[model samples]
Target: METMMLGVYKIPEITINSGIDWLGICGIVLTALIVVLGTWTTIKNFKNTTLSQEAVAEATSNRQFVHIKAENVAKNRQEWINGLRSEISNFISACFDVRSVYLNQSRPTGLVPELFEDFVTVENLERELKSKLIAAQGEARRCLSLIELYINPEEQASIDLVKTAQEIFHRAGDTSFNLTWECDDLVKIAQGILKCEWERVKQMV
Candidate 1:
């Protein structure tokens, strides 16, 4: 009976902590920490994305509008150039609509596909039409200059002819090509008139 009692006392003296129990406690604590941290991170990212997305969209829209307006302005300026020479008596004012079509073509940015593509096309057309128009304007200016110089002091009949040619030059066709043709004729006529005027002036001298 005494030894049995001693054995019972020894059993009670053993540590209450178990290796398995400590491991289980630690695992539970780690699991709870992970859950809390994961939830916080997910919520933060979700909220930030929502707000930032709207701001990004607004910025993109503003840029798109600016680009569109710029394209329109360019179109308007070219049209004005085409129509600038028209007077009250003029009919069928020159309008270079093809210039607008020619204005579209350019490098694209990686924006929404449709808008970006339109901008690119407009730029390319602008470049081509610009070149053609510049040449046409130069030709027309030369025609006008030649008339003013060599055809101004001619006979009254010749003056009327030169003035008619001047009107034709100013009225150069609506199409860029047609305008080019008109300017070519004016150029030829002006050269002929200049030759006559120089000879007549030389004889008078």
Candidate 2:
């Protein structure tokens, strides 16, 4: 060991020959601190990167789910529109058929009442007309039921449509019923509902 002076302070000078190299020891310690700091920084950065990736994955999954749900809703609405339109048309046709049958039955056929053959023929004709009227009425009822099922009770437009459809069904048997006017009104209401649903589908895309 040798003494070195710096102003009023005296310090021991360590050398390799003295079995303790102070400068080399300090260098080793500094290098270890630097390595430890670098490792800690790397670990922190890795955790941040992993977190960012997970966030992106979660966001992507949410978007995909929303998109799929919207597509299904739009598809179902379109199917509903088609089914409702078909049922409404069928109901109107059946009502008209029932009216036609009633009208035909009311009109007198030029058959001699005294002739047994003519009496038998008239009875057969009445039976056939009654059977056809029943079938037409049955079909109209079935279509009306389906149309009501297709409507959403919560919506004002759907409520109005259902009311109109019910009225049409109730009055279909009347010979004096203006079926054309009622059918036109039903069609107008249906068109409005369909158009509104279509616009909602467009917005989802």
Candidate 3:
């Protein structure tokens, strides 16, 4: 057995062996603690990395959804505008035709003598004018319907414009007591209103 001296004392053989054993046990315990701490740190880092990846993925998906929704809204709005433009143009053309037919029918010297054989008769002239007015009214109603379809009813500005157009259309129908005004004048006013609305929508888009 080997004897180890501490300070001025020579340690006994059995005491030395016991001390060595104690030191070995302490070393084992310290090694085990170090391993446990290393394992905990690794697990914590992995958990943080996984959470970060999941958050990034969720944010990307939300961004994509918003982009797609905006694209669809734009497409729908453009289609509505194109359709409304065509309908408004048709309405204006119909109003112009009604004005011309009414003036020609009422003229003493007929505008188209070959087309209107019964232009001199008051009854025939009035009947033709009534038919033309009814057709013009139909076109105007189509314009109103288009406005209702394309515009939000809650928007007060658009609603007021539509009301104005409706009043003008109804006024065009009254030809009582041999009184008639130029239909094109009302039609032109409606056209101006529609163009203004369209310009406002374009700015939003």
Candidate 4:
């Protein structure tokens, strides 16, 4: 053992060495603890940041998907509205054509045996008109079926439109059931349906 002198006081070398060793061990342990704490804090912050970013990305993706789907649906509905309008117009026009042919056939065309050649010509014209009327009726029926398919059966407007259209078709040649009034009603109902759909499309936009 050695003795160290400091200002007339004597300190043992073993005591000095032991104190330095204890201080060094405490310093090392404290440093290791600080490093562990820092690493844990950094890891925890990184995990929180990653989770937040993932949540934001997921929300953005969902909003974009919903917006795109709405646009597609609105576009499709617009096309459907245009198609239904055209079919309804065609159906009404064909019904009117059939009505006109029936009215012409029922009109009085005073003729005698002396005008037999003229009457034969009129008969030929009548046959041509009859053929055209048959074609028109067929076209109207086809359009009616297409319109029914385009409309929702559960809707009152759709039901009324289909019912009026059917009545017009069946009474087109009858000349007694107010086919024109029925057609007008059908047009009104179709207009209502189209207006409602247009409003819905505007909302999506």
* The candidate that achieves the highest TM-score relative to the unseen native structure: 2
lDDT of 2 at 4: 89
For candidate 2, write residues 1-205 as lDDT tens digits: 8998768576878776657888999999999999999999999999999999999999999999999999999888888878998999999999889889988998999998789999999999999999999999999999999988998999999999999988888888787889889989999999999899889878876
lDDT by residue for model 3 over 1-205, one digit each (tens)? 9998768577566643434677888999999999999999999999999999999999999988877776667667666667766765665565555556656665675445455555456556677778877777677677767765765567665566566555555544344411123334444544565576567655544
For model 4, the stretches where C-alpha displacement exceeds 4 angstroms are: 1-20, 107-120
Q: What is the C-alpha lDDT profile of model 4 across 1-205, one tens digit per residue?
A: 9998768567656544434677889999999999999999999999999999999999999999999999999999999999999999999899989988888888866755368797897788789889989998999999999998999999998999898888888888887878778888889999999999999999997
Of 1 and 3, which scores higher on lDDT? 3
Model 4 earns a TM-score of 0.78
* Candidate 2 residue pairs that clash: none
Q: What tens digits encode model 1's per-residue C-alpha lDDT throughout 1-205?
A: 4554433445445666645777889999999999999999999999999889989999999998887776666665444333322321121122222233233323343445368787786666566767765655555555455444443464764465456556655545333346445445544554564455445444432
Residue 139 of model 1 has an lDDT of 55
Q: What residue runs in model 3 are displaced by over 4 Å at the alpha carbon?
A: 1-20, 107-136, 172-205
TM-score of each: 0.31, 0.83, 0.58, 0.78
Better of 2 and 3 by TM-score: 2
**What do the candidate models score in CA lDDT, each in turn?**
0.53, 0.91, 0.63, 0.90
